[model samples]
Target: MWGRTARRRCPRGLRRGREALLVLLALLALAGLGSVLRARHGAGARAADPGPPRTPRLGRREPVLPRPPVPANALGARGEAVRLQLQGEELRLQEESVRLHQINIYLSDRISLHRRLPERWNPLCKEKKYDYDNLPRTSVIIAFYNEAWSTLLRTVYSVLETSPDILLEEVILVDDYSDREHLKERLANELSGLPKVRLIRANKREGLVRARLLGASAARGDVLTFLDCHCECHEGWLEPLLQRIHEEESAVVCPVIDVIDWNTFEYLGNSGEPQIGGFDWRLVFTWHTVPERERIRMRSPVDVIRSPTMAGGLFAVSKKYFEYLGSYDTGMEVWGGENLEFSFRIWQCGGVLETHPCSHVGHVFPKQAPYSRNKALANSVRAAEVWMDEFKELYYHRNPHARLEPFGDVTERKQLRAKLQCKDFKWFLETVYPELHVPEDRPGFFGMLQNQGLKDYCFDYNPPDENQIVGHQVILYVCHGMGHNQFFEYTSQKEIRYNTHQPEGCIAVEAGMDILIMHLCEETAPENQKFILQEDGSLFHEQSKKCVQAARKESSDSFVPLLRDCTNSDHQKWFFKERML
Candidate 1:
């Protein structure tokens, strides 16, 4: 037994060698695991911070979140213009397109619902990053009335395709009681399969303001994103907006609105200096070049551009903050002055209104507005009465008809202003929009320019249409006493400005013709636009060396203003509304 035990115990060296082999295997496993962990850490770091900025590839596909596949060869893909050879039935389709949505709806139908848009973002925006995980989720609210099937659905699909699923809480489509066939059950069925999409219908026509309010009421997200029914969102548009709102809850941000040609459906991105919102004394929204102050404040091209007012169709705001600011004026009938009202409220009520250059949205700007109802005048009146304070006189001075408009009771809005302890409109003009040209500043000879000869006749400068504002013929019509079309201001600069709106036109001699026309006012007060209202009431044109005379046109019974040799005739003599008073 002792000999057998000694033989078994003699294998101690071999057992030690086996134990050493096990230790070596254990060390190798640990090394492999450490390499894997290090690789994962590197991948995560790459995702979070894409190393020091390289030259941004303008349209580079940076799919941090899974995105919809781009149909590279599809029609209207890459935001290219789609034109159809007008022949046979195609012409009728084009006509139908015009009649329907005032856009090329026929071509819109042919485009893929998930069509890819060209990356029209600035290089700085492309290089910008946002914390996606922590950003607030938004409920996209799109309000529509008689919207086309393709355009509305394309808007929906574009958002879904571009927005990260986790960040998009839901999409609420508020149909403003559209009577169209497709908008009823077809819209619902089409949206049924789409996750996080809801369609709510108004029992009666609620108009845009109320329709959006309905959508906001039903939203269950941290932020409310309002988009027009005919918009194509670019990739990464949502993140920057959410990030801005996340950083400052009171910030209401808008995307850089690119133009989608209504006729050709081509996407036009403005990579140049961005335009900010401004308004004239008439309370109409106008786009102005970014002021030097605002430009200086923007450290990068991707920074937010402060605006006096928003274009209004597309913007994002924190849900809680929006509600606190009263969302929108419920009394506003339709879509006219809502943007300005919201803009004024935002600035006066301790909120930030900004345009994020990092986010881009392409909107179809129709050549002419399809809707006939222009409650804008009434809506503007309400806003002026409620918020404009003493500055409301500036709006009223240019728009005397607004005084008669039965703008619904603004008591509630006034109460809201008082409740919010909002700053007066004076602060808004002086602090926020000092670049705006205030006619009252250089109040010289303003109001209806009445002809001393033709009793009750005044210089009426009505554009044949909204598009014909520049270089339109000025005519003499019966003075309406209303300040709109007849509103003329003989500026201290010796220019007779047709002061209806911004970029105010000056009474100038038509090239090679003695006819009086409205030309864009030049800064130099050139000889053509220069007019001297003599003490005798004669409007002497400096360049033409003639006086403006009311001449009866040979073709029609109507009279037109013409430049002729200076005379003592009563027709050449004019009196301003201020003088008449």
Candidate 2:
């Protein structure tokens, strides 16, 4: 229900090559976090306030990257000697460990937010100049939960430096109750100089979902652009997205996300091809290659590609349409299923979602999310209940115990759906996302293994204990409720395979051996590898004639399972329940 508008730049003394905006951009950007820290540290000794916070001149001068401050507990002399002794492998591991701790980013946040990246415009886009003078004004919202200071400020810098101020209304920063000492009032004070930047602090911990909703409520722009706290907006990123929306107001547009290497802080732009979003039956979103049909129809790389789903971190939506379409499921607790729900809602509610290949933004995809996933599961359930219709069974089939998980009240969401008169999930599947593999929802037992007797512990294949060799002992650790390491799938092939992305490996043992080992599953498992799940929920190995039981020596605390004679003991009694991702 929207149309494209071809506009040109405003006549107001706007300089070429983004030069005229440097002075204004400098004032509107935060002082380096390193500068702020040094000022605070020298406050007792220095006479006056650190002479007018360090200003960032976006286009006028190159910005210097900041280094991480050495920890107070650092071991000095002995550490240096240990490093020398390490020579090779030990040193590598130590460096890798330190890097991993900072969410697998560079040894430090050393990249300038305003640093120029390779221009990613297709020839079609670069050759055509549009009138952006009347494009919809946008408000970029970023919500963070205990994020690193430098990275957060850099994200803000990237936007101001790359975007034309006329189209950008403001940038809203929402702190989701971060406990970091430096992220306190100081962060607000530092950001105060940036006229276009507004900082909001939460009184209590609200996860990313609620925090973003709060940000959206405070936004005043015609379009709301959501950027992750660690992203860098490349040159010309904003124009294409807004231009697409200008063409069609109801169209939700997202940038082609480039990779910012987790370890090297390198910028990896598009590989000259486009990608789309998809999800598995588990409701987990993943990036996949564009389908062959889509490639054949929209042959040009520059053509706008309609996406079935979003990867959840970044996108721009029309403020009016976002509200009319139902902003977000407030009942959804945290950040897991919101993107998928929004994608389905957009397609089902008569709006279209597209990814503009011309827009490029670099996002830091952390190896693991920082928050607890318990709420994510609850959130996914809410989406399934409100919008999935009968198709929700596929989700439940993958996460069987989700039926027992409690999601908050969905009556309001369901009513909202009815009020909007949205299309069903089936229509979305048949039309928008036919490539998604639908699960059969066949009933069976799968997930985490729990020892009925030792309720305090669960079966864990954690490293050193289980990652060592074929016969490495698996231990029982206190239940963490996260099945990431403990999850297993009981296949029709009669093999117990770990429920990771690639679950080709299964639990098995040799004919005469009592020790269980992780091995690649065969189409037809041998008698020793086969296991029968009795109606009583106990596994009986046909070859060994014994029940898999967790047995501990009297003198040791080690609770490792083994092939013990069937005594029907509590240790031998086990049950399977789905684990939250």
Candidate 3:
């Protein structure tokens, strides 16, 4: 009975234990199922409950940092200080290896950004149009004077070959009295068939200055371009000049002048790069290269630069401004000095001159000068003297060896100045165009007389009062005490001697010296005072006391006449100093 009771209890205990284990297992399974259901539900909620797409936390947002305030003056001291500070910090940061590694990473990221960005926004890419139709229209004027037939024909053909038809309007050839008969007959016969080509011949010689003026007067186009009779037009030559003129009405444009060897008739090309022609105080032409900074800054070849002066051989200008500036100083003598005169006047009177790189022409440099009916050298010298009078002192300073006595007449120039009411050279320098480089005032002695121990002393004197001399004058002095040989000896002995001894005058001063004063006249007799010096070292009665003193002094070798107190007398009377050729 006891064994049976024990067995029953054990069985009951075992059943209870099994029931508890089953309950624990069921709870574990329910917990697992609930976790799976919650995970699925969370995923469903994430998919269905989206209002706005959430940015990934990895790369979407960056922490904000305040930017430095901009300085009031971008290029001022404050801005410069800020820039220096930043640069210093950057240098400091770059010095550390770890920081440099981080910078490398950042730079790699920046490079990736650049690669992925749109090409249209990229700054480094260049877009250019290769077509010629987009260029501006140009009218070319060729002035011929006994030009070689082959060369003239080649020039026309070269124009046709190089210049686009749309850009070219008219090629007017102004014949300035060509001696060659075939040039007229053949040029008409050959070029007449071409479009927009016309020839105008002057029965008499009009020279280069007037010839160009005549052609320009007849120009129907907005821009008037001048070219020599013998020239080879380069590729894409016309557009640059026309483009510049279109942009600026007052722009005077020139082409790159390459040298054509006269002996070989071959194009020497350029030495290396384009050079703008310049001028000296003497009104002589020179050439120098364009600066590199200028090349980088200019958007096109049309940009204006500080040209020393225009090339004058090939240039284009607007018709309106040309007329307004009175069209090339009509009073200028023949060809030579006209270009310089025109250049100085244009620059001084408000005009910008530039040499365009895009336009190029080859000029034939002659081994010998071409024959001219109008004494070309003398005519040029005359023009230079008349137009560049103010600059003469500076010129003689630089070229001390040059002989400059025989230039041209200024009578016509005087007439023009009166007619135009033109401003004085000083006014032109200070007001009309201050940017132009006018040479500084230089005062010195020049010529053979200065070398012979005689001082050609002349000082530029401003009037004490408002009254100043306008033209020029020379005071003639006849020293009654000395002859020519004695005068020469005295001048040789003394450091300062009178330059002129031919009984005519003192150095030529500007026209304002009016009051005549005689000083230290030994002669008291009125009839004896007025005398003339004979060739055989003698004196004869003339009229004035000053004349007598001059003649008597010229006759003797021992006496030296001194100029003293300013007075109005026959001895101080001045005559116009005429320059002998």
User: In order, what lDDT does every prediction score?
Assistant: 0.82, 0.72, 0.48
Task: State the displacement of the C-alpha of residue 236, model 3, in Å, after optimal TM-score superposition.
Answer: 0.6
- Listed per model in order, the count of residue pairs whose N, CA or C atoms clash below 3 Å is 0, 5, 15
TM-score of each: 0.82, 0.64, 0.49
Model 2 gets an lDDT of 0.72
Q: Distance from true position, residue 140, model 2, in Å?
A: 0.7
In model 1, where is the ten-residue run with the lowest total lDDT?
1-10
Stretch of 10 with least lDDT, candidate 2 = 75-84
lDDT of 2 at 505: 52
Q: What is the lDDT of residue 542 in candidate 2?
A: 78
- What does candidate 1's lDDT look like per residue over 26-125, in tens digits? 9977877655666667755323323486653222133323446667877878889888788879889878878867888888888877777777778777
Which has the better lDDT: candidate 2, or candidate 3? 2
lDDT per residue (tens digit) for residues 64-133 in model 2: 1222344433422111111224447865764674454444433324334345555655767776465655
What's the true lDDT of residue 172 in model 2?
97
Q: What C-alpha lDDT, on a 0 to 100 scale, does residue 52 get in candidate 3? A: 80
